[model samples]
Target: MAAKPGQCTERPKSVPGRTAVLPWRLAPGIALFAAVALSMIFAGSMLGLAISRPWLGLGLSPFAPVAKLQDEGALWLTAVEGPAARAGIPPEPARILSIAPLGPGAAGGAVLLTGADIMEEPDVLPSHAGMAAYFARQNQLAGLMAEPVELHIAALEEAGSDTPPPTAVYRITPERRRPLTSLPAAFWMQIGVGLSGFWIGVWIWTLRRGDWAARFLAVAGTGLMASAFPAAVYSTRELALPDPLFWALSSLNATGSLTFGVGMIGLFLIYPRRLVRNQFLFVPALVLGLWRLADMLEWIDGPALGRHLAILTAMGAIIVLVGLQFRATKGDPRDRAALTWLGLAVIIGAGAFVTTVILPVALGVSAVVSQGQAFLFFLLIYGGMALGVARYRLFQLDEWAFRILFYVTGVLLLLVLDAILIVTVIDERAPAFALSLLVVALLWLPLRDMLGRLVLRRREPQRGALFRQVMDVALTPPGHDQRAIWAALLEGLFQPLTLSPLENATQSSITDEGAGLVVGGVGGLPAYRLDFADQGRKLFAPADVALADELRAMLTNALESRAAYEKGVAEERLRIARDIHDNIGVQLMGALHSLEPRRKDQLIRETLTDLRDIVNNASNPELSFDEMLADLRAQISEHVFAAGMRMEWVVEGGDSVILPLANAHTLRSVVREAVQNALKHADAGLVRIVIRQGDDAIFARVEDDGKGFDISADYRGNGLENMRARIIALGGDLSMISGAGGTRIEARFPFGAERRRR
Candidate 1:
């Protein structure tokens, strides 16, 4: 059976209660909005930490203490003491090092403290002074001190005569000190967060619009912006900015951070399934943004606003997300488990946030550590959100598990093979070679199976089975009752995998030897012939041609096969005839001539007659040129005698040429049939036979002067059938012309010398 083009089978329904909605629901939208808002708020707080550390209502001052001591001329204080004392230090004059303040109003200040002096009597030093001094240097002491003061301290234990002003001094007089003038770290972070949000919005919009390219662009932009902000702010805080380079870096970092966060969140929201439903979630993010603007305009401090807002927003987002999960599980039990898992991940992430951000802030831990912990929590939350939104667990669990197992097994196998190879072989490359062999051996069967299944899956399901069934039906043996065969075919094709048979279709014509069938369409209409031996028949559809054409082809193939067999038989007989003529014919003629007197004459005549008969019979195998002419003349004579008519036979150009038996048989049959027909139907009086040999063919004309009949109307049926078949089989032709007074039959057989032209 020949293969047909493949097709996809109809997929079976497996899951029930699955419905696709056109657009996102309001609840999911709001939840997603809240998530974005919270993310923005946290991101803003991170940015604030990267900026100036401001003390807002903490009562723990961020400014340093300045004591302006008015003393006699050229007097240097060894130490100064004040009432602001905690537990560690009290009236410690040696603790005073060097202080420099910017001009009179104290817009900027500088202080240098000696570690030796602080360590020597830290217990005696006032705690307030120590704390105030720490804050003053760090925060520039602009709001805390009113007058510039310089404190020059001389150590009591160190001699001052050869010392370069005791190596450190405090400046109490007001001296102008420049504040670090660069863009706030939070400003760049805000820009980054804003840009990330913008791009994320763009991506969401593109996704809604079904523009994949635009979505990708938006995603890329958001990713770049998301990473930029945090990186810039962090870098600025970590390194001293002497120029605009830090500010530029901050801007770039803010942009990058925003891009990253927005892209990641946007992808989560737009793809997979929605987890959030409240559009109002965007409100908190908008509030954080407004707070950032207010800080820029000096209307409010950003850190205070951002920190509180972020905490509230985070809590709100968690509540909304949890509510969404509950809603998602309400009607569909199938999605309940997934929703539960997602909700748990979200809760765990929120817990991490509280532990890292809120608790540490409440305990008054180091701001840097707290902020870092908060950022860690943010990372965890985003990671969990990404997983939930991408439905990574839903589709990837099996695949990931399989990959893990495969890798583990593969690695173990490789290690074992390597160890075995190393132990057995001394060659340096043996381990590698052995590992390669082992890997191939392990994978070969599985790879082959995978390829086979892939090929089968890709193929049209019905084509192969249909082809086999059709071929089996077409090639069923003749004389076996086609009714049963048709029933079998119908049964075989009635299954779900096979094509249904048309009603009333049956086998119309069986080949003569039962090799093939000519099937009929519905209602006994003839269809094409199908041969058991010929595979090409499968290329055509059964209904492509008329019934007559199929029947004609079948008959033609049968006749052609038979003709070939006959031709072979004729060739063998001609070989036998040639052997007899070369030996016995001459021997008989010589022996007859050698006999005595009347006996000699009679014997010679009889021997010649016997030889002629033998030669005639030998021509039946394949006639020589002279023998063929004689046969044509004999046929004409016999026909004329039977009709009681005078006959003339003439032969020309008979040479030492031998024709193939197949050609000779064809010529004889044409002449005999034509002459007999003329005698029976044409009613001829005088008959003439002429045999002529040309360079390319042997032409025989059998003419009769007779009352002729219409050639086309009267000359059909068995005689003409035999005549035409014989001539055609020998690669020759027969033509007849009969009219009013006479009839002529002509046969042309190209043989021997004549075949050279062909």
Candidate 2:
């Protein structure tokens, strides 16, 4: 038997929530990803240190002809205690006619080199003379890493005035190894990009776990490490690596770059909005894989143009995919916002990558900077993606796109100007960059401000007009329409694309990641939902919610005050009606009993009946529609009988309906006046009365067969005007038509017309 749970020495082991992020039931763990990332970084660092350990003892660097105008014929050679330096090689600068290998394993067909060889361009057409010369020198010096190098030294001579310069051959034997601690600054930079990108990508991926975009970003990071580690060994070579090893490293770098582009393209295609199906996401990788194989096999113009062209193609695809996503993300402000930032990072990083690797090959020129340094830009891409997960959460914001776009435009413009000045005029980078900043500040900054004001900061509506509109809704009379005025007021302020009721909202707030706003209810009014601020051009922000809250509060207070005033007026009216009923009604009733003449008695009876109607209508809060119609039919029948005329009363369709006492009273007065006027003036033999309820309104018509009066003439004297006023006051329409036969009065009173207006 098991012991009581608390008393047991052994307890159940706790297991945290484990969700599979991979198909093989792999769960996300930070420590697991960290271990894998660190392992990769360590392996890459060791490989880079090992491959670059062998270095020629001489510390040679590229010599600029422009810097040393007097000695433009030779490259610089730093003084060092090495085989070539002790063999009487010039320590300052030396012009070499040709360098021949005493053995095999060096690059460039094992051919003779010359001073002119250092100055020659590689392509069929030359572009950027300085870059071309630097490339030639780098290629020539690479052979010096081999053993037993024979240098044909040229005597110091100037061009155009020199006879044949004396040349002598001197062979340098053996190669001294460089310590791992002496690795160049560029190697560390390359490794830093690799490790940072991988770890950041993994960290972000761990958060989202199963998100496709995050996974693709992690792939891009892996590509960064793969590309950078190999290029670090090759690009930073102090001397030549073996031909096979060099080729192998170059192929790996090409593979990694293309893979990076493929990953970026896939990320854009899936993130923010899925532009394509999951199965087709790997199409780009498949195509690039085939291209890489062809390049390695020397099938597509060999290494000269194959990898560069493939890289260019991948970039082109990414650009196209970005455009597609932009169109696909319409009507979704959140997706568009995320896309804007993500697109910026990918395009800028890819641009820098291609500029260093492929742009040099294009324009038929050599790279202006070391290609390994370009890996740093990929760090920016990784960092941005991590921030998307860690800080901004990618789709959580909608109004930041325009701001970032504006800043990026200004930054890229400054960079372009600075680069131009550096390449074309100023040799000092700091002064050139400072001058570029000053120029931009003077010229483009004003334009940027003007454009930003036009696009981002719209002028607000006048405060006076806004307040007046609010007052209009608050001051609306009890029987008149105010809902239309309220709706218009809100429309004039925010101009949201959609306005709907918000269920159970208690406070005004930005919602749906700034895609919408919810305003709380006030003064018995339900909450409202407003989406896509500025008519779908922008998203609702916190400032808009604050404004909504203030307006709602103001309107709520105004409505409450209005209610209080109406309450006071209603109470006073009730008191006056009571006094009139108690005091005036008894005296009038006594006067009617004392009358003797028939006409005077009839007048007194009518006055008493009118007083009774006024009291009853005022005291009752509501009246039934069917009851009112029945009472009217009976009264009309009796009046027609007393007048000795034929009566036709038709009623249809109001079995169970009710009306407010005020509306019922006004409608009753209008119909009675119309009947009375027809009997007294129309001189008709027969009268027809129709009272019917239509789908959305109540219709009443009274017609007489008598001498018709011309409607063109002024005809409002016979109680027509009073009837019209009564109908109009109740928010209904009144009409009259007089013909050769008789006159017809038709009135239309919509159901709940006054209710809606209120």
Candidate 3:
């Protein structure tokens, strides 16, 4: 709908596509993303709490000796309570050799915990799993005990024989459980990693709405949160959990693993360029999803075989896709560079996880790192992805790094200031906070701006100053000197590491994966290359290309204007030459032919004087208006006397100002021509010249009291024509009146206009 004449309809505002805020079209997704993200974080924290809580809601718990901790593979009694602790068992490092139920349901089996069984381990599953399973089953059996249990405890070589001997046997009923105190660092670490990945994905997605790469990255982030959040609960369990609950958490973990595999696979297949069709991505998804489902249902024998296999297969597919992308991106340095960094992340991050956690579990050995610690390796994945995004944006490395540095510094400084004010000095929170803000504003912010400019070292030349430099370069006569000025100006702007002659390339571009900035010739300056911006600290970005183009445009315009001005100067010199030939040449020849010495001498002197005046007027600087007016009077009187006519020169006004030297020659020539014409052809006995000066302008007239011819008649002589043209060229006017009265020629000059004076 159109608005009425006086009404206005405002367009909606949206965040730019380059930054973090979502555009209007994509803003609706933020709510969904936030809801899901908040729920996931909350759920993860609760799950951690659930793992440490008392099972079955009993005040007294079972499993007096907590065994087979995740930290050390060997059984260590992390905690002991109830009958076991009362019976002289210490809360110290001790191995649980075996646990045998003494009542009903006990005859079926004796669980051996933490040590190798006499029976050979299964070929498919690692021996480590056997020990872990025994621990879990023992904890479960003890918790469900109706009567009592006999536990065999063995001590390591270092355990002393004190209250408990090297080997002790205890028949005790377990009834105590330790209350939850706190969660481990690994728990919060998992949350932190998940949240970081999620936010990074959302940040990219919002900035680059509708991009398939960003969409897939968000999906990958979802997978990261999913896998890590659930694993944080199950992987860090203290003693034991019920069969149903244990399996349920494991199932979620497996699902998260499979989901992560699918997202990662899709990410590689589509990023940089879509390698496969959208529907084709479902092949990996379905296959991995089914594999994980089958693992959960016990269709697969070994623990996590399906999950590990799915991950390995996805990793393999990612390598193949990256290889294909490498070949496809040949000669496209930017895409190739981004691919290199992202590909390196997959190799380094996932490879570390596989080597430390997955492969070790498969090979029946202790992992190099704990499972929770293994998750930290994938931080490299998110970090690499972020780096790739920055590359695509074409940010100079130094500039990007400095922005991050200053941002972090600002945050830290503000925090420190707040701590100092609130904790040490100020008594009230409000005043302390206000003081902190003030300090940060006065100190940290200014420091950041100052340090940031120095670190980045990109001088964005002001438009006026840049114009002046470009004009300097343009005005220089074309050669080494002009090129030097151009190079100097570019140096101030870019501060490139090295300048080299561009051999063949002749266009403005960010070349060599941003390592080189090449500029084509402008204003006849030779093409040159600026390499490694900021003294080898950063790469040239796309923005630098635009800056170079602007400089070239400015220089081109300045050169054109200078060229036009030079053309005008040359034309003016040509006009002066014509006057010298047409007027002075005639007198010099007559003097050469004269037979009397006096007459020849007088003519020669007068000709020399006129020539001197013309030459001086052409090149002289502006003189005082009063001085110029007096000089004009004396010169005209001398001319009239020489022409054998009476002279009447009048002057008016007492104003003193600088006269216009730019066109003074033209003004003088115009008056001289009018006076000479009157004496030569007006048939006038007396030639009168009038001069009047006002504050803003000056008017002059030359007339004769004699018979006046028709001023409208066309003249072959150039005297009147030259007079009219000269006055008009000064941005003034000349008018002639002749009708049986003395011919009057008037000239007007608006010396007040500075533009006219210059």
For candidate 2, write residues 316-408 as lDDT tens digits. Answer: 888888888889888776566667767878888877877775777665666666566777777667666544432234633223443444454
**Model 3 TM-score, all chains together:** 0.50
Distance from true location, Cα of 52 in model 1, Å: 18
**In model 1, where is the ten-residue run with the lowest total lDDT?**
55-64
TM-score of each: 0.26, 0.47, 0.50
Please write out the lDDT profile of model 1 over residues 1-758, one tens digit for every residue.
33111111223455568664454534423433443545456555555544443211111111122244222122222322221122122233432444455556555445443332211011111232442343333334323333434443443343435554344433333222312333343445444534444433342333233432234325534444454444444333321222243333433443343333333333333222343333532443455455544533435333333233444444555556456556745753324444555456545654564555444543444233323233344334334433432332221121232233233334444555665566676356665666656675678447644643442222223654554444333332222333344445433322111222344545454442222445455322233344331121111112222332343344345445434645665775686587557755665667556656766566667666655556555445445566456435634554465556666666676456776656766777777777787778777787787888887788988888888776667666537877877777667788877788798888886774443211
lDDT against true structure, model 3: 0.65
| Candidate structures ordered by TM-score, highest first | 3, 2, 1
Q: What is the lDDT of residue 672 in candidate 3?
A: 84
Tens digit per residue, CA lDDT, model 3, 1-758: 65311112344456677545533463424433553446455664656555444431111112334333232334445456556676566667566666667776666555555422211112124333553474466346535443466767766443343564478877766544423433467766776677667656655555444555666667777777777776666555444555555555555666766676677777777665567766686787788878877865667655646566667777788788889878877765555666777878877887888788777666667567767788888889886665544443322132454354345446545665777788678888888878888888898888878765653444677997788688667765566656777899888888886787666665799877687899888767888898766655446777799989998888889889768856865775686687789878988999999999999999999898778766655466466766666556656765666666666666777456766555555667778888878877777888888888776767888889878886556554647887777677777898888757788888997764552322
Q: Name the 10 consecutive residues with the lowest summed lDDT in model 3.
A: 115-124
User: What lDDT does model 2 reach?
Assistant: 0.65
The deviation in Å at residue 719 for candidate 1 is 84
Quickly count the clashes in candidate 1.
Answer: 68
Better of 1 and 3 by TM-score: 3
User: Against the true structure, whose TM-score is highest?
Assistant: 3
Native-to-model Cα distance after best TM-score fit, residue 606 in candidate 3, in Å: 29
Clash count, candidate 2: 1
